[model samples]
Target chain A: MTGAGNSALLSIRHLRKEYRPGQPVLKDISLDIDARGLTAIIGPSGTGKSTLIRCINRLVDPTAGEMLFEGRDLAKLAGAELRAARRRIGMVFQEYNLVERLSVIENVLTGRLGYVPAWRAFLRKFPAADVARAFDLIDAVGLDESFATRRADKLSGGQRQRVGIARALMQAPALILADEPTSSLDPKTSVEIMELMAKMGAERGVPIIVNIHNVELARRYASRIIGMTGGEVVYDGPPEGLADAHLKHIYGGEEFL
Target chain B: MNAAAREWTRFTPGERIARAMLYIVTAIAVVWSIRTIDIIPEFLYDAPEQTADLFRRMWPFDWAFYPKAVHSALIETFHIATLGTILAIVLALPLSFLAARNFTSNPILNLIAQFIFVSSRSVNSLIWALLFVAIFGPGALSGVLSIAFRSIGFVGKLFGEALEEAQQGPIEALTAAGAPRSMLLVKGYWPQVEPAFWSVALLRWDINIRESAVLGLVGAGGIGVALDAALNNLYWDQVGLILAVIFCVVVVTEIVTSTIRSRII
Candidate 1:
């Protein structure tokens, strides 16, 4: 995950996604993200920030666009190639979407599922190195090592999100896409999660793209900012360049800011 | 709604007469059937005394007969329940898969699977035992087969609903990550369904115990055979002993199943 290419780790050109046949949700959005840094996409709900990041991993298919990752076009690939691409890209979710009944360690190991064969994972027979890596990540994420044996259902919202981040890191991904990862947490936990993501991204030199709703929080943690509105990019530059007028344009109201 | 429509609440003269006529017709039909069948209301009042006298004659559950009743007959009851449940599980798991709308939403397959389930469950267990006994010999095999057939329908319908309703969040995540179909079942589906599987299987175990106890009455090998023989020979004491043993078995099964259920949830 370190220093694959210091140049823009992920590049996009003319990305478009339409859930319905004629009505487009994301209209020809394009942006580039550098490695080893935090880039935040901020906007109101349903403005397609989530859709734009999901489109990078092909969780939602882009209707039309070219997404280039390390000189490879993501839109043109299919089947195994797409899966291989996903293995290199990790995702953190808003709901802290750990498998509730699975042990915390089991949930983290799911990040390694792309690399491990089906039968091996089924039998819970992961390699010693992978198992040790999962333990290391759990510890690094500030979770008690004993928590690995407990089911994910028993954890509080903040603790569960920590496990979610640990799972994403277990993949050793070159890029991380977080879809409102801190929205479900309390204010303090949200800031802590933001700090954790920034720290993890810096340590591993992985390009991290997060969709956030809190503009101030984004400014605090992100080196770069990409604001979206009405399925298109409204602003893209350094965090300092994201002014009050730009926020008004992206959210359609200046009073809140 | 409208003022005029709201004002018109009462029935007219002709409508009232028509309703009275329908009631009179229904009364006449009921009276005729009662007469045809020679209805007797006295049975409800008179039978209680006679039933009490009969019970008094068979007092104390014939405690002396309990020892003989505890041996091979009890063993046979366990066998009937075990074999029946195994057979039911074999047929039920696959049928449950087909019946799950999520797995097999095809109209033809869904209809056929449900039809098989409904047809198997339409008759009572005793009726099934009777039919199987008439077809096969009067033995434990017939009783076991009958109980299994009834259980297949019950477990299949319940477990199918459980499978269909699995938390779709995990499955969607797995598919988004390009997991194969089998991996989706193991990772996304099985975790949600495990508790449900336990509850259903444990419930079926208790039901099979009750069924197996009575299955012997059709000449299937269990304690019910002893009860049937005692009743035929007018040995009320022996019949009382068999009933007592059956009660003990029911209570033990209740305790066991409840314990298992508590652990699962």
Candidate 2:
């Protein structure tokens, strides 16, 4: 089936995830993500925002429901089909999970692992085109040529996240999901990272669904805002439509706001 | 009541009693061992004289005998250690992946791998040498197999632990990238665990060197065969030279491995 709305790129329907048998992390959640622009999911910790994003990629399998993208059910796929589907959807982690001992260029090139043969990957003999694309994406993410050879552990948090974004974009994805990509960063770095992600997503014409706890960043960067509380969506609309009442409801208090 | 004057002790009364019992048991064990050994006063009194005589005989180094006996035997010991370590690494590498709970996740496979490691470790290399000598009919091949079989457990166990300790974040990133199991291993797991893998291999090789030097006692070829021949013929000087050679080799290997380990990581 196509997306719930024909214009949507990913349609998640009645999705539910329970890490435990009876304790659901994500309640029956249904949302349609459009083909372009950034959609930010704003929620407090423990509200299943991370789980929801992960479920779309099947990193955390949903207990029930359908994730329809590119005319296939992501939740129903297995083996090779699942991997093929996953390669089209890029992911960025909260921790900027670059392999610590590897060089920056190598970490970024890992995005093409799904398409590269095992022997080629092992030999670090990625195809010339993929290598060129990886370098372009790295430059696009604001890392200079000098940083490419440096080991990942030597970089600052912002630099590492830049590499993380570059790696995600190297997948040539139709959709990118960033799970709290700036949680560990300073406010300035967080804003820069958000800006970078938005720029990369827009430049590539890829729809981005980001789970961010920063309400201000969400308001500033997102075209659409999805407010979640207690594993359920409290609001789904354009950024300007998200009012203080909605924030109070989503976070369960006006104390922090 | 002011917290009952803060009554506190490092050990409870029961623990104190247990500690006392442990000390008493240790004392009894020492006394029992001394009684069992049954050292004669006559021999004890003459021990120093015998040692002095032995050393006197061992002096001058047996320099002429080095080429005829010690040289070839020393070479054989080195070969056995190197070959055995290489063989163990090959055999243990795959088993380590199976044993690591994070890597395999199959409890049955993990259990099988653990069983093999435990079995290999439980049999001492000397005992393994004896067994292999019977099967392979006594040669450097038997010595090599003995060291390898005994070492598999050690190398596998440490490497498996290293694999298990790999950070989950990098693994998650690769899995999200849709890398297959093999790609994940080559790019994801291998990069993270490379230093540990090399560390374990080098450590095992160092241990194998010391162990192989003794394997020839059971007729598996190594310097111990030369030592045995010297001892049987009562060539104390020759025996002394063999012992010195072994000591020097062990010291050199220790130095080499330590230098390599420091540089690698």
How would you encode candidate 1's per-residue C-alpha lDDT over A1-257 as one tens digit per residue?
Answer: 22234467787878888899888999987777777689999988999988898889887888998888867788877888888888788888898778889999998888877788899889989899999999998998889899999999999999999998888888888998898999999999999999999999899888799999888889999999998999989899999998899999999977896
lDDT of 1 by residue, B146-254 (tens): 8889888888888888999987666655555556666777777788888898888878888888888888788766777877888898888778777777888889988
Top-lDDT structure, candidate number: 2
**TM-scores for chain A, candidates in order?**
0.96, 0.98
The C-alpha TM-scores of every prediction are: 0.85, 0.97
Off by over 4 Å in 1: A1-14, A62-82, B1-39, B62-70, B102-115, B134-136, B176-178
Residue clash pairs of candidate 1? none
Model 2, range B1-265, lDDT digits (tens) per residue? 6786697789989999999999999999999999999999999999999999999999877889999989999999999999999999999999999999999999999999999999999999999999999998999999999999999999999999999999989988988888888988988899999999988998998999899988998999989999989999999999999999999999999999989989988
iRMSD in angstroms, per model: 1.8, 0.6
- Interface DockQ per candidate: 0.32, 0.82
The residue-level lDDT of candidate 2 at B86 comes to: 96
Candidate lDDT values, in order? 0.84, 0.93
